[model samples]
Target chain A: MPEDSKRPDEKNLPRFRPATDILERADGFYLYLDLPGVSRENLVLDVKDAELMVSGRTDYRFEPEERLLESEFGNVEYVCSFTLSDIVDAESVTANLRNGVLEIFIPKTSKTIPRRIQVEYQGE
Target chain B: MVIDFGGFGRPYRLINELWKPSFLSQQSLAYPPLNLSENASAIYVRAEIPGVGPDDLDLVLTEKNLIVKGERRVEKGRYFRQERPAGGFQRMVALSAPVDADNVRALLRDGLLTVVLPKAQPKSPRKILVQHG
Candidate 1:
């Protein structure tokens, strides 16, 4: 009977820190994730409580019909994940995948948004 | 940016070119590079082809080998920083075990291309008849 086994040092959880650009604006934050070999079908985007998790995989296995001379990183499977903070908007989160890049727009929470509050004058 | 992996005097040399830089290409996307794994059944491979479309890619399997050719074209009307490799890229890999080509599947999402190659069936076992010779 075959069984699933891994080295004790191997971590079962997926770990991904996509290349991101946090442009802090007066309104929101933009996060860009580099996810290649992942399709809309295989990708999972979820926000539980205050945590955000994105996971996907890339499979590149073909039959043995041709001759290969040199191979690069193109044959490995890909899996990655990330965590979100309270400042990130969960309900309004939007993600798009095009040309192998995953771009996510995360607006800031209402409390985190910068606002100009007028201070009342109380001169004693 | 095109990075030629070079070839051994072959007609078509293997190369890697990206017309636009993907989020993964950026220093920020800290995903692990491409990797490989194997089991008694078959071998598996995953490649990160960020910013590359399916039409621009070509996968060729010939004579006990595999070849992946594709181009990463930059989106038109961009000029801030053009560091992405534009044009064409190719990766050649050696096949360690037999594969089921007809049943292979490829899926692309999040700028990544996943190829599934199944292992070939093992040879059938045979019974020996060692009678008094």
Candidate 2:
């Protein structure tokens, strides 16, 4: 069925919530999202107003002549967002998509990193 | 972890439930989502599987059923949110009709696994001629 033919209430198709994993390390945080069938061209990643948003669309089309016996693979659009904290340096964040998985690295500022301090005794 | 005891222990159970791995759920353990389509001479089955490589998949085809088995490994990381299940899966799909297993072609692309099974012979509707009395 064509998307436009659907009623207004159904116009917005169901979006798939991609499962994400967030790991906090000493230097920074790493974010991973499982997005199968999504290509690099279809992915959109942006940080606006301290919010990190990731979205993508999967491309799967069926021929008109094909008869569907059973259907479970529906059209899915991936959408997820997270609020970034002050410690995350959004400007220096990097992302890479490989094998249907996306990985984002958010580096922390130098001030947030822990540093060791040494003290010398001055009393005799 | 701090335990909450004010609300009849409901919150604690919820937290404990959330901590469990999602693959333990019955729905996911049953089978992965699949779609089946057929045409005049072939049957096509598509399964939605993300983060699984082609090498990890194992397939067994018979005249009546197609068994798909594979595992999606959990990547090494500290997970803040884990919704997608990571574990082994086995699904045996019953074919509507007998198929030629030798001619079956399977393709995995974009995390969608599609198997095309050709029929032994094309079955076409026959047109019978009307006899005049």
Candidate 3:
């Protein structure tokens, strides 16, 4: 957003915490992060110490010869982390990046799913 | 200045993260952040909008302004926690130097939209020296 560049210098650009969506279903939990202008080569996805970390650098600067007319955004990093729950299968986790959107699938070990128990009749 | 906690920060270092300025007063933050730059030949306008294809975007070029209108198509159904912005959005960027609208070129890749607008050559009359003969 234009909120990125309040100051003129690129050094003042704040690290943008990308907007994300977390969804839970029967199979697993899903995370969708919006990281624009960040290519796959510049993206980093790490799962360590029971934490899920997603970060990327946006190389938005133009050539040195180009003069900036209006600077709303600049070279800023996008970072966000989440503590993985016990049910999350960190080893089996998979991620995909497409059209600047990062999707992470955190499959559960059949734990997050609710199961119905049938009661037996013991009438005498 | 941005303070980086390295790649992955401490797990407990997320109390103030969820309550971002985006969730509060969204009006202050413009949608689809744009960066405008210019060289001798053309002016470049770059916008970051994920999940939006070229067909979804519409551009209207004027001598002094460029109106960008687009829709970010999103997956249907319901999401337990929805944060990423969806739906239609538009922005108008003012241009200082007149641009050749006919030659403007727009390209979309990896969700980043870059528009190159060639500057129109100045048509002002050239100064002539009038020497007495």
Candidate 4:
């Protein structure tokens, strides 16, 4: 059948690495991951043993009778992990997924936050 | 702070190498990955484009080709690792059958852009009946 012929190679489908952007600021770090086709329901983010693990499953599937003319975006699992540093306040880390893009905010620890010191002048 | 790919080690590398052929072929075709499918009466096209809004997309359909153009804007930040490509991209896909451009419908959801193009009516084969003498 033409539909069967167009079926994706599911057996060989590779776990894709989502493109990520990590930015550092004075207060914290911002992580942006491009995860197209992955909805919030399928996404999973966790921190274990000082590692930030991000994984999700995309829900792009074809019908049994549908004929695929071009096959570029295949259904696959997304997996990527990053090691967290001591400077990051793990307790305050927050993440939000919008439009299939996952944004993670890792605030810096108290020691990392810059502090201003007041000076007292002594009269001679 | 440095970010590294943990658990993506030797085994993952081996699997990636095995999958490189297909992946390379797709990358050679267009910027954003696309999927095109067709049924008896309609053709559907989907492109993967995360972080892009509806306002940033421009779609045009002709008799033989469907053109998609869009831009992905990058937020301002100090980068440590920037892998997602940002900028303008355009792609024109040739249709296998004639489509009604005016009836086409497009939807953008969850970072996937899907365009449904209704197919024009095809000429049906006529049957001939044998006459008994």
Candidate 4 lands at a TM-score of 0.80
Best by TM-score: 4
Residue by residue across A1-124, what tens digits does model 2's lDDT show? Answer: 2242122234354465676767776667777787877878888999886778888877766645678765544556677777777667878989988667788888886666444578878997
Name the lDDT value of residue A97 in candidate 3.
88
> Tens digit of lDDT per residue, candidate 2, span B73-105?
875666565656678998988899778878999
- Per-model interface RMSD values are 13.2, 7.5, 7.6, 2.5
* Deviating ranges (above 4 Å) for candidate 2: A1-11, A25-27, A114-124, B1-29, B122-133
- Chain A structural similarity (TM-score) per candidate? 0.62, 0.74, 0.73, 0.76
Q: List where candidate 3 sits over 4 angstroms from the true fold.
A: A1-13, A111-124, B1-28, B124-133
Give the lowest summed-lDDT range of ten residues in model 4 chain A. Answer: A1-10
Q: What is the lDDT of residue B89 in candidate 3?
A: 95
Question: What's the CA error at residue B112 for candidate 1, in Å?
Answer: 2.3
Q: Which of candidates 2 and 4 reaches a greater lDDT?
A: 4
**Over 4 Å off, model 4:** A1-13, A112-124, B7-29, B123-133
* Residue pairs whose backbone atoms clash in candidate 3: none
Among all windows of ten consecutive residues in candidate 1 chain B, which has the lowest summed lDDT? B11-20
Q: Which ten residues in a row have the lowest lDDT in candidate 2 chain A?
A: A1-10
Model 3 scores a C-alpha lDDT of 0.73
How high is the DockQ of candidate 4? 0.48
Which candidate ranks first by DockQ, i.e. highest?
4
lDDT of 3 by residue, A45-112 (tens): 98887878888877665655787765545566777887776666778999998888898888877645
